[model samples]
Target chain A: MTHEAGIPLGIRFKLLSDTPQDSAAQVVNEVVIGDYRDLDTLREFARGCDVITFDHEHVPTEHLRALEADGIPVRPGPDALVHAQDKGVMRARLDAIGVPCPRHRIVTDPQDVVRFAAEGDGFPVVLKTVRGGYDGKGVWVVESAEEAADPFRAGVPVLAEEKVDYVRELAANVVRSPHGQAVAYPVVESRQVNGVCDTVIAPAPGLDETLALQAEEMALRIAKELGVVGHLAVELFQTRDGRILVNELAMRPHNSGHWTQDGAITSQFANHVRAVLDLPLGDPRPRAEWTVMVNVLGGDYPDMYSAYLHCMARDPQLKIHMYGKDVKPGRKVGHVNTYGDDLDDVLERARHAAGYLRGTITE
Target chain B: MTHEAGIPLGIRFKLLSDTPQDSAAQVVNEVVIGDYRDLDTLREFARGCDVITFDHEHVPTEHLRALEADGIPVRPGPDALVHAQDKGVMRARLDAIGVPCPRHRIVTDPQDVVRFAAEGDGFPVVLKTVRGGYDGKGVWVVESAEEAADPFRAGVPVLAEEKVDYVRELAANVVRSPHGQAVAYPVVESRQVNGVCDTVIAPAPGLDETLALQAEEMALRIAKELGVVGHLAVELFQTRDGRILVNELAMRPHNSGHWTQDGAITSQFANHVRAVLDLPLGDPRPRAEWTVMVNVLGGDYPDMYSAYLHCMARDPQLKIHMYGKDVKPGRKVGHVNTYGDDLDDVLERARHAAGYLRGTITE
Candidate 1:
């Protein structure tokens, strides 16, 4: 949602999905229930929209090219979006551009994975599918060659790489317009629990100024080299030795940038809209010294509103953003942002609010 | 317009308007084209809504009381809203509660107005209709009995008040829930041009701390005394001798609080929704040292989007809010907010952005 009133008049959101029950369908101006795989359905949806963008990277790249050929404005185009749609393409492109990444190679056979593992430190190799993987699915850390066969059974090419010894994960979020204008947000530290993002802190507490600048520059260079035109979230691994390596890339708003909604001078969603429309970018300055965001995963509690009294009274400064979805075990239903001068206090407030909403903390 | 997503799912908006072309009707989930004066139509609309609220105060108070009698939730109820709907009632209530106000009286004849004016400093008394006036309409500064005849033509009770010698006007915005939880925002200086609110500066720059506290306390007291729920905007006149006099009151989100959208930790809109819902109130802290909001009146230009490139590029930090109204001469179509450390810089940026949007400034 946008903070500015009357924006709904200029924004005519037409959501295309297989069912009308999609969370996005509730707020959009129109909903087209159809199969994304069908070119005719995709074309029909594109016909009514001035531009076409995506919340997911799984849409067939050829269909995006078809829309572009039909004179429709498709942000990030087929060429720039392919890297996000396919992991193999992204790894190859980043390597060619000399962007630092883990040592890896595509393995067609289980034996090839074993050989690659042996070439580095024996056993415990990171394996991933070339396509259709998200939130740690289709990824595995195999300790032996026998365990590596699970990825090959899927009949897709497997990517094998050395699991770098990293201290933590950082995300460099930047938005680039079609006019080549770009602005980078401060690097943030992202914490993962069970392969899902749990928390993110802006400015990455105690990060070296020189390293922070380097991370921003790296993300900016990647956005320029890929010709990506909207939000680009560059996930990085800051190794124990202080070197940064690219882990993944997303072409749209990512979970790591959620803190910017309540903490920054301008949110990533607003910047994404501006970039897609080719308008001038807004300042990405932080409004406070520290901001902590925690994801609210669906748990024991199904009634989020009932918890509002306790949360609001406990921490009046917290800003909660809920995504309308049926509560389910381990599902992400919402998130909370807490910002202030004290990092520890902000973190505690955000964590407490999120935990309370999830029913993980009764008191 | 809400910052939190998924609010549309829980709150399905059904707008009751006279025409389908009403701008509010376009974004809401449903629309009933019916007259507010028709009891049957109002009853029908009320059947589908969980509660009833208003954007304007013109709806008859008795109809609202009838709805409340039927167990329909009417926020700020008729008793509290009538103070805003009728000038005569508001004046009497303020006087009974010992709230400081201008020397005033309800006059049945033109001679009564003359007597009241003579009892005061004489001549130039402000004459107003007891009900139904907005935006400089139904209000006049009468210099003589001949000038006072204009109010009699309406055939409504006239209110006569001594025109106080004041330094400037200020607005104290506060939100109260049915549960008795209330939060007050920083008092703001509201500037008027041609009797229309033109600009607002948060914290009423250069205001004395004790006086600011007094204004907030007075607004809070008024809200409690009137049993008001939802947002309350208390308009005050700062006398040249360092005292505040109540001028008027509004029971909904007032234009003076628009700067809170970008300048405050919790905006007035969000707080208003929380208050009406009877949920815990949010913090009312200012995000920056100073915030300046300037209304964008319709001027020579009709194409606002064309000016975005210039304004956005020139002031990357400026926040603009449009009302989606077709541009007409002197109409309030939108507003711009600029904030930062320096008051002078913030004021200039806000004025420049608003002037540029109205096509009143070239550079």
Candidate 2:
């Protein structure tokens, strides 16, 4: 968000949003209420900016190409961004580069889905729409042919893949520059609840040293191969066999790296700006031995600020970041980060603060 | 500034300035072009705010009291703020509370200044206007009767004090909430060049442990005695005789505490906001053993961004905080903060980045 870049570095940020009430629009310097799909609006917004980047990957790629063709610099240009925008493209590209990924194939017929499952572990293959999916949407774990028919109803190209038997989900975040420089953060364990990221622990406690190193190297390689000129987050699956499989790629700052805001020497947001601007990358060293970050989801509490006093008073070391948004049930309203020498203590503090904010815990 | 507070916490900040072109206006949520001297304007501006605070200590105390009387929350109320606004008041109160301060007296006539000089060390006494002075303004080191006439020109009462022969200057910064909770930061050595703060070294390298503890206690005591509702910076003179004399007090975030942005667990700006809002204060612990901060004054270079690539590339750990302002020679445009385990290395990196930004150093 502009809060991360504009404040610390004093960058003049102008946001383009569909409405004035967008969380970022409320905080940035200028807000142009317009649709990103409209080229005229995009041109008008780009006029005042030195470089163009993104918070979401849903922006049309052709529009980005048009802007780049007009001599405007677009970070993580369409070539690299498409891999995140389309699952089919990402799977093919990773396969070509010998990157570990789940067995996948673009399927026009439901029979191909069954065949993929039959060739692999059989049934319960992952079906994805390949485009326009986020936060568990357009994704399904199908066991039988009847359940697989749901994805085909959307009339979009469906990508079927073998669901790996993984110990846990992990994320390796890195930022790259146009100058061929890149820095990788420690691999972290990301816990999900109802397909939404609920908590993340940096350095993935008890993770195999070799696997952690391999995850970081794989992310760095992806940044180089894809020519990603900004933050690249490579979500991975740590299999029971100790092999790492690439699951997803995000070309912007990821939720898994949010702990870096307070725990790392230089935050991922600050590094993202530097990478996109072609400035030197910052040191991705942790300030503490262990850091735990827990997302604060909206619940029955409408006035979030009311809970701040107790949370702050209870844990003075916790760093809470709240997005300026109207609270909605199950929405990610904010996050709490706690870091220290003791992993258990840090985790307890972070989880307690987050739970308190969500009105799930009280004392 | 609001840029640091507003952006990080998603707070809607509206700054009241004399002009729309003020650097803070360029980055804040809104700017109301009005004079702080105009009570009507202040009232109108306060109508939209929950709480009121300031960046400078020059605002009329009477106006602040009036706003508080009207049910608006004025942090560090007029009673506490006046100590920082007037030197005579601060000296009298600190003296009454047995706080260590230079021998001083309020003088109405020029002859009183001459008599005070004779009573003290005889000649070369420090004379300062009791009100409306900052950054070397309204202060004079008078050695003769004729030299004392300059301060009378301001038509304000002057305070004369013994000129302490000190080894160096130190600042102990602390923040307090309305509930009387306070946290003290590590004392830092503040180096002044031409009456302006040039660089600050946190934990004051080679400083005695007892002196550091005494400085922090003094600052905390001052905050408690004054009922300060936000940040209180106690500037002290570290005499050659191993004594600490209170030199000045600031009721807001001071330049001396800027090192906290990158060095400490919680920044002064964040603490100030927390204090004013009556939220619990954050931990004031240092993230590193040593931190060095250097101010960047504008020089011959009109294009400051042109030098950033080199500065960032050279020292990726340097945290640069630039004020969105036009380049004016000798004007404070930005600052750089560097922290590490090595004091010498941290100081070198900070100085190099700041000097390069000011075009004082090349390569």
Candidate 3:
């Protein structure tokens, strides 16, 4: 949550902790002070920074409102940011904006869900809590009359969506600055597990050129419509018929963007700092023709270092980033990225390394 | 000089410095302790480290001999490293190994200066102090009888070499590990002012294929002959007609190899650490077709930050490395690197930024 009010300048900045090693890659010499909940303190911290940005969007809306009131810069201002902070807000905004979203109904009670399901797609719809859901937590799938009733007692904001049979999922990311200039990275197909991303392939190999353009344009449109001033990641599903349907929106650097750190001409992190600080957007072109990124999950393996060494020894070009974190089951720890002409050669080695890091080591 | 001891692993390896910065980029966690002049203390520090390496070659041979006696690993062991540490040792080894070196005469008294100037190539031969000279500090051009006497009077170990008319100055760097594994980065041409290197263009623009191959081969042969265990940067010159001649040897990371930091797949610094630790040799292949590196000399102008901002704003792709040194007139505080397909684009931008950092601000 403290990541929201991060300095719009500087690279590799992180909060200080006892073990700086196990913490995130610290950006040297960035200014981050004051409280997240207090608007006056946030305003004082935000003043004079060239561009205001976020690592993650969890800042209270009123705090951003206060920053805007005091004539300080805030990216994706409160109106656009609130949608990412609250799922109900996102669902309503997407609907009002005429974007194609999944057929779904919001429900406050078990009776409301039962009635919606009776009239809608009958089974196996995704039930998601409106807030605080990430990496498959705070989300569930319900198939029957008995299952839907259980979580409503906890008093959580819930929504049901028609679980379209997605041929594949894609993430379209575009970075915009306060100057209204935006650039999009190649749309990538993201493979997920239990609603958590596992791998991303840029250019979404064999994806229709028209669809890819649509996805990029849609992401750009969303960035402009929402008045987002930094990087915006739009998660989508390509149904069997190949229509790109909006699934979710992330207004900060996303998991799909990790490849840009090494694979692109300018890294998403560096460009994000440029954008929120209102600097001219850098070239978002890929350095190589293809770049594939894989997530390191703690779900499968206990000791990832053994796999990490093997990967480093095997492929000299594979760029490995292991966030200094205590690995736990199903936690997102780090990622491995590779870029080159031979996508299969790089992807195979990159995928093998990622699988190994995620405890999926096999013969 | 304790850089010869070894680097600690990991960025999070708190270096016990106020700002948590270390001398080497790769080595992170291990504590290294040593005083530059104390022979006995340096031996102890070298003995305790996981590996032995160097940032520069200034350690005395007798001290290295002492460490060798205590079973500490001194990469490019004393026998090989002395070729760089002492000029007499270098001329003898390269001559014995059948490498092309400038015709030279070693001298102690002022008398040898006049005789070599007449007997060798004539009035304009080069005079070099045998030890402890860097960045043109210990080198001088003795055009005639009068100019040659000052070097000998200063008690400097002087050597005279016939001055040759050269077309371009060049460098061929080879990296070798203890496991007998060696990798060579592409040979590069260096631009210098007053014998101080100003810029390096990798692949040595307009270099014929045979010359580049010859440069790489020569550096590799020298590395093998000397049993050099880390990087060996062999400076060279391509004569107007055809042949290439060896200029000098840098036993540590040479200025020319700085291109590898951003231009190559595996940086020379990371590779040097790998070699010293007997780890696998990484891919030393160039990432792009062309690579260029330019040193950021200290500016006459007072404001360093403003200079950095100006250069950064103009070219986002230029990779800037600041050494945390206070800017003084003509001091080397940092460098900027670039790589691209078009030689002109990379070269012009790199030189422009270098000029900006040096406070020249050219059109």
Each prediction's number of clashing residue pairs: 0, 0, 12
Report the first chain's TM-score for all candidates: 0.96, 0.98, 0.88
Lowest-scoring 10 consecutive residues by lDDT in candidate 1 chain B? B1-10
- Which residue pairs of candidate 1 clash? none
Give the candidate number with the greatest TM-score. 2
lDDT of 3 by residue, A1-363 (tens): 112112112222323222334333232233344456676667666666544666666788887887888886677788889888877788887888888888886887766666767777677767888776777776778887678876565577887778888899999989998889899999988999777898888868899999999999999988888888888999999999879899888888888887786677766766676677666666777888788888777765566656665676788777777665678887877788888888798789788987877767753
**Candidate 2, residues A1-363: lDDT per residue as tens digits?**
545565667677777888888877776667789999888788878985789988889888999998898888999899999999999999999999999998889987778888888888898899999999888889999998878998998888899988899999999999999999999999999999998999899979999898899999999999999889999999899889989999899999889999999888788988998888888888898888999999999989788777878888888888888888788888998898999899989999998888888889886
> DockQ for model 3?
0.21
DockQ for candidate 2, please give it: 0.68
CA displacement after TM-score superposition, residue A104 of candidate 2 (Å): 0.4
Q: What is the DockQ of candidate 1?
A: 0.46
Q: How good is chain A of candidate 2, measured by TM-score?
A: 0.98
Most DockQ-accurate candidate: 2
Give the per-residue lDDT of model 3 (tens digit) for B125-159.
78888887788877888777777777776675787
- Name the runs in model 3 displaced over 4 angstroms: A1-14, A17-82, A104-106, A149-156, A298-309, A324-330, A356-363, B1-49, B59-80, B149-156, B304-326, B356-363
Q: Evaluated on chain B only, what are the TM-scores of all the candidate structures, in order?
A: 0.96, 0.97, 0.91
lDDT of 2 by residue, B25-66 (tens): 777767789999999999999996889998899889999999
